[model samples]
Target: MAHNQFELLKQRRFLPYFVVQLLGAFNDNVFRQAIIGLLGYMAIDADDKALYTQLAPAIFILPYFLFSATAGQIAEKLEKARLIRITTAMEIAIMTIAAAGFVTQNMIVLLVALFLTGVQSTLFGPVKYSILPSVLKPEELTGGNGLVEMGTSISILIGMIAGGLIFALAGAQGPWVAGIAVIALAVAGNLTSRAIPPVGAGAPELRIQWNPIPESVRIWRLTRKQLAVRNGVLGVSWFWFVGTVLTSNLPVYAESYLGGSPTLYVFALAVFSVGVGIGSLLCEKLSARTVEIGLVPLGAFGISAFVFDLHFAQPVASMAQGLTVGGFLAQPGSARVVIDLAGIGLFAGVFVVPLFALIQSRTPKGELARVIAGMNIQNALFIVLAAGVGIGAQSLLGWTIPQLFLALAIANTLVALWIFTIVPEFFMRFLSWVLVRALYRLRVRGIEQHVPDEGPALIVCNHVSYMDALILAASIPRPVRFVMYYRIFNIPVMRWIFRTAKAIPIAGAKEDPELLRRAFEEIDAALADGQVVGVFPEGALTRDGAIAPFKNGVERILERRPVPVVPMALRGMWASMWSRRDSRLGRMRVPRRFRAHVEVVADAPVSGEQATAAALEAKVRALRGDAA
Candidate 1:
């Protein structure tokens, strides 16, 4: 397990795959921008150039709609590394045709090659994301995804810059340079693909579907099979929509508002791209290398905040035109505009990475590739829709670019709220994550080594405070269905969070026998369905700072389910504000320790048959040591 995301960049398992995908993204952008550059060299009028500019994106996106389902099936049926090599090899051939088009200066040939490039990209899309879970541990998913997003952001920015410069620098020889450059990049990507070690296919025994329309529909349905996975896919597509709108507007926004030439447009884009790279890299540290969907809400609102400020940052169009980048920077309010762009990109990175990680982690291995393919198809639709919406808002509604941005900020906020409402887990996790981090500097030991990544397990811990469940959930990589006391489960505002988390609430037999029976039933069902169920064997928050006597409820549950039992301990939580110590004193609780050091330790699993309540309690006590 790599503690640092950068470490994966030095290892063969991740580095080769990362490089191959990075080069492929770079090549795609290079080829597209080079075609744009080629227009200046051709004997075409402004109308024709605009038409080509408009047509190129539609041509490039067509294959994602038409072939994604089939591509997804291919990715699942074929070996992963072999599929990557095949896609890269196909890229080499496609770029060869593109080179020919460039050399001949044929618009028709170039369009055909661009369509082919889209086809190649559609084929590679499924495997590009699905391969991550196979190679990286669950704990490393956030970091791995962060690195990939960072690579992609930098590559696209650099590739566009490189490709755009070809015609500017080479002039008469621009066509030759563009042709050779794309081909060389294609070859490099292929060579890197060859170094990716063999990774087994997700669904080797799966049959391929030849009919694309029905297959695409089936894959789309697959993406919706799980609530979290479905919403995650939606979130990913929404990211694309937001990105398309933001990036597409930048050129005009830079020219009309900032009073800058094409160079300044690039400079604006570069700032945004750098922000994305920084934010993506920050996900690992912010998330503690876990798939923390809490960041999603934070990212969502952050995007709206920055974008909303962007409208106010430059509400009026500039009177000046064709100003240089330096000149634009020298103007008042220019710094604020730049900051807004960068902030939007930064939050966008924070918003999208976790959703990708969530979709990958939660979806079944067999369906992941196809689900990603489905996501690509939806993403294409969203991109096209975003372009149309932006155009319609400006043209039909007679709105300025700043007004369109203002609408975008409001729309983004509404959409995020809608998604969070439909799936409160994202919001719930955010709350828990915020609360836990604000209160404690958490350290963990033996969790990655002892806690099972997959399948059913019983987690028994010593409960010290009302926040034990949230703290444990934050500490552990996987979701744990905690069996907390009903009183704690129903605590005013905290009740919503608990219920959203699907925490099982139980009462004592004397208080409510039926409720106790139902709780036991829910726990058994959860465990039977191959989920982690957490229990504090003490059955209540400790009145004193000492561990309480173990109850027999855990033993009863184990006899029914008989799953592997993990003993965990929480240290230094007893003195926290949420603990019984303050409440027991009948005094108003005040903040005694802010950001206190807390440790969550887990011991090796004990077999269900061997894990008596007493035994598990003893293990937890030993794990806690003298810290409590």
Candidate 2:
């Protein structure tokens, strides 16, 4: 019930888990970068350094592909907090081995430790995300996810910076420092893990799946069971692909194009990571504390826009070479390039957070960890594919880095369009969200307290304008299957939005009995399947800015399905442009007020048996008060 996302950071339920994940991510990056730093400390040749660098990522990622399915099963079967502690404890042991490798300056031992670190990470992956829904409410999902993403971005950036500096600052003592640093971080993460209060296992009765390959395939199939969740998983994988491509090229992009040294490369990465953290924090404010997938399309196109600009921002190679970070920043067009990098990361954060929340919210809790496991497997593939694609485009095709970026921008747009096309829900929500926010400053009361969170419920509201359903859709947290008059449902461009939203369209019995019967059937089915079905009990828009008589549709729906009835009212909408107030001439007119203040209020639910149409209407009228 924390209203602010930052509030959760102060609470025991979220704080310890947050710190644990942050330290873990920090440790992972630190260990990885320390390995890179060790090359310099040991004075390894450039060729050997390249070989080690090439081998390291593959070694690190191998466990995700090999053991993620088994990891998912283990996460499900074992209690979540205990599982987390075990992973952290394992991290302690793994980092101990990594420390030994660092002290001994043994590449073979380091690689083995790196692979073990990947195994530990793979084991932690499912629970990292799957634990959020258990600890946070549905409304908190977006904010909680945003915070986690922000923490991760910042931790990775800082860890890389900290680890990279060890050799540079400490000289001959770099190895010992790196060794102690990673071990200390591991210990810190473990200590924080101990504070994460007990979270029950998702599927305590689940049998462990020993074979990773077949189990991976099975879990992958499980992810596809729900259309939204399936696409969400795909979106997350695509994010990894995009991130891999973009981040992988930064070093060369920085050194070659920007004409800067390694410091500038880290600077570029730092800006991008900061942008992601900022955008992740912004999700809560933009989404109004709801799991608003509408942001996904916005994030998608924003990424393409900034990345496309990035190509033009630095289309040609720099005339100057070996510039420092400050020198690079002093050059013309440098600000634009920095902004583009930051913008891409910002949108990337926006794009991925909602999808994670969506997947967590929609997937069955019992299967969530495994589904995340499936997602991780796919993400690994995408990351590999991204590396290959980036390499192929530059090495084989002989494309410049800017040209590669141009291709990425175009590819990102196409992929986003394809995903939105397959699942119009993402696009539909985007459009509705845009329209609602543009037209009204919406305020809500009693919804979070009164509206049923999990089970089926019928929402009866007083209809005031044509935009009622869309407004209500934006205001309500859950997707409501709104039953609207067929005419409004079929309104030219709006028809597509309505249909994609799965809004039930009905006609009067006299107009079309078959359609009416079908609409009723759909409503009943939706309610029976445990969905929120919204209907304006007035059955038509009010003409005189007054509530109309309640229609019997509400009574009929209740008599059939008998779900909990929530009475809602939309105030300040009657005078809006979409209303019937000035429609006597049957011609459109400019709105009297742009960005009007609107209030959507709901009263406590009435039992289905007790909710007569008249009683529901009275409740809505009372909720509306004298606002109309």
Candidate 3:
């Protein structure tokens, strides 16, 4: 509510999901690292050791494919927060089983535990994702996702390192601290879970499916119907495919080619996680207030660049043996390689956060959990594909680690291309990029709560700055047609901006009254067709900082095709560098952060007649609240 970076986290609704997911990632890596480090390669044949070691990750990702659809249905039937709490409690026992396997040195039990952990994660799939739309407004989805991505990556990296270090140093007793830590994290996650507001499930009467393949296919079909949800699933799948390759093979590169101890694996993972966290945080900042998807492509470029550099970073000669963690850091040329790996992770942050939020913001109500389950199913398929590709490339194709990495990077580009091309809207974000770079980034608070995701609607906001039209065009997930003053609409550089957005130009009754009529007709057409029509009720940017009186034009337009009317207000824009008052005289007077603090707040819709000047002004004032 504060619009501060920490506000999203401090809120109880988001925190529960955040903490539970973080703890789950921590537990996963902890168990994985423990089992991975416990390998007795000397006891096994050489061929069997490689297969067994790789099997650990394969077992964990398998259940997401097998059970995500069932978990999604269960989430729809049960109370989500309570269900999540039970799942968290179950994690405690699951990790206890993991501890037993570690203590007994029973490989089969440990593998089964890996499978169980995967199943637990699969159950978590829908609750983790679907809950966001219920708790946060549309605008908040991007920031909330940014925080979640940041938390998950940081936890995984820290968890893997801690798990490996504890197991290697403390032996059987090592899992004791890990067990206690994991259970506590899960408990903490559950405590926060209670703070979340309740939301009912969609299609509660729908029968649950026992079979995953058929059910996954069915859910996948459901996801396809929702464009945004479909893209979300694809993006999540791509993430797993890329992650699987990097995680599965990097250990071999570090050990066999780079000639390093097990610590090198830690180093590789740490670098990647740091990159992802940084990229995730950057999404909130780069996207401004709403979900600006342009950054996804920017992240794609970073992935290609650093991943390519990493492939080429390999030395022609072998390195010295037995490098400690510190020694690895101290090695010649190691720093650049580490930084490159970290860069890959950072951009991954940018790539994934938006896609997740896009799904949350766009999925149908009550079905959020089911859609998340659908996403998990896609993730599983990608992971399996990643496994097959990794194995075949390394064992059959005889590709070197560096060559394999290069191929993966190429694969990333191809995958991104395929997904974006299928869903052009993701790449249709080019307009967003143009708008942000053209001026300072715009911020909005609760705007999404105001705009109806579907049905007919008219949004009336008082225009203040020249950039108002562009800002409105860029931020809203729904494509809108803004009614702007004809004079500015025809200006050379400004004309292109208006043209790009397909804004309708209107003049006052005293000047080109016909254009005004045409504008109303257009608004009518848009509303009748169930699209949003955005208009500056004053019919022009306010010459004064205070909102100008609303014109009957909005009332007239609404009368023609009466629909829901949503009111929006822009604050701090009067002081923006692009404002009329912010001409050459005031250019040097504004503070640096002044531009950043401006916000557009949205209020709930009112009836068309109730959208009179006085009523509209009151709504705007309410949205702005008391300044500061």
Residue-level error in angstroms, candidate 3, position 420: 3.8
In order of appearance, the predictions have TM-scores of 0.97, 0.97, 0.82
lDDT of each: 0.92, 0.91, 0.75
Which runs of model 3 end up more than 4 angstroms from their true locations? Answer: 41-48, 172-197, 256-259, 314-318, 441-457, 462-467, 474-532, 537-552, 560-607, 613-628
Model 1, range 1-628, lDDT digits (tens) per residue?
Answer: 7878999998999999999999999999999999999998886999999999999999999999999999999999899999999999999899999999999999899999999999999999999999999999888899999999999999999999998989999999998899999999999989998899999999999999899999999999999999999999999999999898989999999898888898989999999999998889888888876789999999999999999999888622266899888888787888898899899999999999999999999999999999999999999999999999999999999999889899999999999999999999999999998998888888888888889989999999998988899889987888889999999999998999999999999999999999999999999999999999999889888988899999999999999989999999999887676887768566534455556678999999999988897788889999999998
Q: Which residue pairs show collisions in model 1? A: none
What TM-score does model 3 achieve against the real structure?
0.82
Better-scoring candidate (lDDT), 1 or 3: 1
lDDT of 3 by residue, 1-628 (tens): 5274469778766765777788788878877776666664125676766787778777887888778889988988887777887787777777777767766667787788789888888888788778777777666677888888889889988888877776567765664655565556656766766666666665678788888779888887877887666876787788888888888787777777666787777777788888888889888777765677667777776887888888888543236666666776676778777888889999889888888887776677667778888878777778888889988987999998789889988888887887767666566564546555554546666665668867788888877878777676666756678888898789777776576556889898889889877888887888887788888887677676777777778778866777888888777777675667665664545574244456777888888755676687678767756531
Q: Which 10 residues in a row give candidate 2 its minimum summed lDDT?
A: 585-594
Ten consecutive residues with minimal summed lDDT in candidate 1? 584-593
| lDDT head-to-head 2 vs 3, winner | 2
**What is the model-wide C-alpha lDDT for candidate 3?**
0.75
> For model 1, what is the alpha-carbon lDDT of residue 46?
98
